[model samples]
Target: MAATEHLLRQGSFPAFFGIVAIATLVIRYLYPDLFSQSPISKLPYVGTHVGLPIQKKISFMTNARKLLRDGYRKFHIYRTETALGQCVFLSRDSMVELLKKPDEVINFEKVVIKDFECKLTKLASSEPIVPHTIRSDLTPGLVRIIPRVAIEVARTIDNELPATDSWTAHNIYDKLLRIVAISAGSAFLGPESCHSEEWIQSAVGYTIDVVTGAVILKLFPSFLRPLAAKFVPAIKRVDRHRAGISRMMVPIIRERKEKANTPGYEKPDDMLQWMLDKAPEYGIENDEEMAYVQLGVGLVSIHSTTSTATQALYDLAARPEYFQPLRDEIAKALQESGGDFTKDSLYSCKLLDSFMKESQRMSPISMVIGKRILEEDVQLSNGVFLPKGTLVASPAEAVGNDPAHFENPDEFDGYRFYRLRQKGGLQGNLNQMVTANKQNLAFGYGKHACPGRFFAVAEIKLIVAHILLNYDIELADKSVGRYPNKFHGDACTPDTSKQLLFRKRLSGQSEI
Candidate 1:
């Protein structure tokens, strides 16, 4: 790491080239996860670094679709080294085997936090995370929450979007971030204060700052990241935003304290209250602990929902043929639910659901998925042996686009999965946006698959339904059809900086 940093700091073209070439050869090749961790496999050793040119680094950083596709096609089990560490990129079968291992064997929970330890440096956890109440409690009440979420989405759309068909070019990603944060905030932070501009900014800004700090820290090896980035500007930015959130939550926390043992008090039915309720026993050791719960939910929920919605919206913009069909589906669904975004309405949105899933298939938010760090060295179900501490990930993008897995994999067929769902009788399973299988690893594939996915699916669909019903969308530049989403290491998020043109459609619905 020191040598890599030295080569990077020199600023000489030769030294820079040497860093890529040699690192690719040594750290990535000669010392891949397998070779370094005693990976006993007979299959071909396919890696991103092998045969990769120094010049492609820039292209690879932003778009590794080609690289991942080739690697997965060539090897059933391969190792891909990342900035944080090397992870063996498993095939579908191997991933299933990896997933079956108990958390005791391949503990994703521990390694996942460690992967970002330098950034979310103060998260309080040493045991398996006490599952967020969103699952056991809120999810059952999601049918009830849907209307409130719809209300928030409607409010955000009014604030962020222009009046009906004004025909404006806007950075949709930026606005979507606000939309999801504010909308999800309504549920997570409670109705009393979730609408505050300062609170919303802090929620969104804290998430961005955490990612910024993590990204900067990723440049250095794990050992050095703490010392180097712990007090850096990016981390300090996270601290500042967190402090802002703390200031806002203090009154609520105090009020909760006052009512703690009062005979007439009734517990609030929301995440903020849940976090506060669990804080004393879980980790609300301080004000910072209280803020961490809210920010953590926002980080995963808002960021991921925004990315998925942005990509789907971009796909809709590029393919105008999809617009009316999707809108019609939403309209029909709303009518079925008596003009509401209810759970029944969500189920009725089969086409819109298909659109979201198809868009994710075409442009995944992450290049890899099911990343698990081995805690107990064991032979996989597929006869591949992974030693302890190996970071294992499946080439999710490649697998999703594989010819064996998906027919006409490269083409953007919006209803492809919907048709498949009908023909194959998969309606009860894999076709849904929230379902995660070996074929659809976006939400992941196992016991620890994202718990927030159901909420995400519901949230995304509501936002899209509102937009399609209210506006006609197209690319700001007609030539910018299906431009690939940007990549940052293994994480792929929508290029929110791009512009999309929208005109208010005076269709039956005005906003909601």
Candidate 2:
């Protein structure tokens, strides 16, 4: 028995050595530079040659600040190579110049969105057509319906606040995401599906998963993403959600198609109907294809809207003093309009509008905007010449935070734009705010400047007004840090992990 045990122990060492030797050989062959005396190699657990700890540790926040400093002081232009061997980055003036030549220098949706295609096959394949269709068909419907949809969504939020007499602490991020998802879904699919728990959850999950997956895929080489996506938990989840969305939308598309063909059929008041009406123009006559288009819309609108709404909610909950002013503006407008939450009523709530605008300024989804490939040699007013196929964008966050434009730019002044308007100045001047500009570049600029901005603004205002008028909100933990400014190179998103708490305000306790 002793001899048998000794033999087994002796055999184990050879097997372990063989595995280690093979791993070392592979690492030496694949990544010799990584094993070199680079700054990254000095870090513990990452000293080995095989893994990618160095790049992984370059947090989005760090990269963003570095880019900002470089663009502002040293280089005045930022450049980086994308995984696909395309040179990508921004020049400060290139963004402004691109706007002037929209036809010649268009947003390269394919390069900007290459990561998304790994999981969303349809979005990957349908390049210029998808954006064109969105601009033509989807945007118009969104603008027309946003005001009414916003009011309905706001009312739902008002009714659903957690039951509490006093200011209660809860995770505002979680609650806000749910509200945004429901609101966006209402706008996209109508109230019937929007209010349903299953649909709302599915939409939110799919959006988060897909966006996360896209970012992850973008970090890796192109050839590896397909293999990596299947193994990555987030990408796998996105694929499942895509399948779920496809299943959910198919029947709705079929029903709409069947009704559309029938003469004198009553028009359904929803996005599905709008798509059906415009599909023929785009040669998308089939029900299945139209349904896929709807799915894409859902992904874009839901994700962007939800993230913005959540950010706004976080700002509101964190600053209790601003809540009253916002509520006062909303109430006065509602009272003036006979308590009707109509388009005019929403427009009249200028303070709410200003608050949302300010929140977006401080926490935009991206620090840079107007990404375009140089179709030819382009000269900027600043005397920089960009070569063909070079990517360009404005430093929106730095511009927004610049003292020359905004007074006390770092401080969260909710009435920042309202004060500007009170001074009889132009409200959305790109030169003044971080993201708006002849150069500000938030929703973009020129013809391609998000055609849906009007709709998005109206929707957010109504939702915020509804929440403040009814619910009493506050933070769950006073010690926890407020939402961090999310950074992904130049792109930003509201901090998702942050949380806030809320409770329903009692009748007769309406402070506003």
TM-score to true structure, per model: 0.87, 0.79
For residue 107, what is the lDDT in candidate 2?
42
Model 1 whole-model lDDT (C-alpha atoms): 0.75
* TM-score between candidate 1 and the true structure: 0.87
lDDT by residue (tens digit), candidate 1, 475-498: 887775675677776777787778
Off by more than 4 A, model 2: 1-61, 73-75, 80-93, 115-122, 125-147, 158-160, 261-264, 425-436, 506-512
Off by over 4 Å in 1: 1-37, 40-43, 47-63, 123-130, 221-224, 260-266, 280-285, 424-427, 508-512
Q: Judge candidate 2 against the unseen true structure and give its global Cα lDDT, from 0 to 1.
A: 0.63
> Scored by CA lDDT, what does every candidate get?
0.75, 0.63
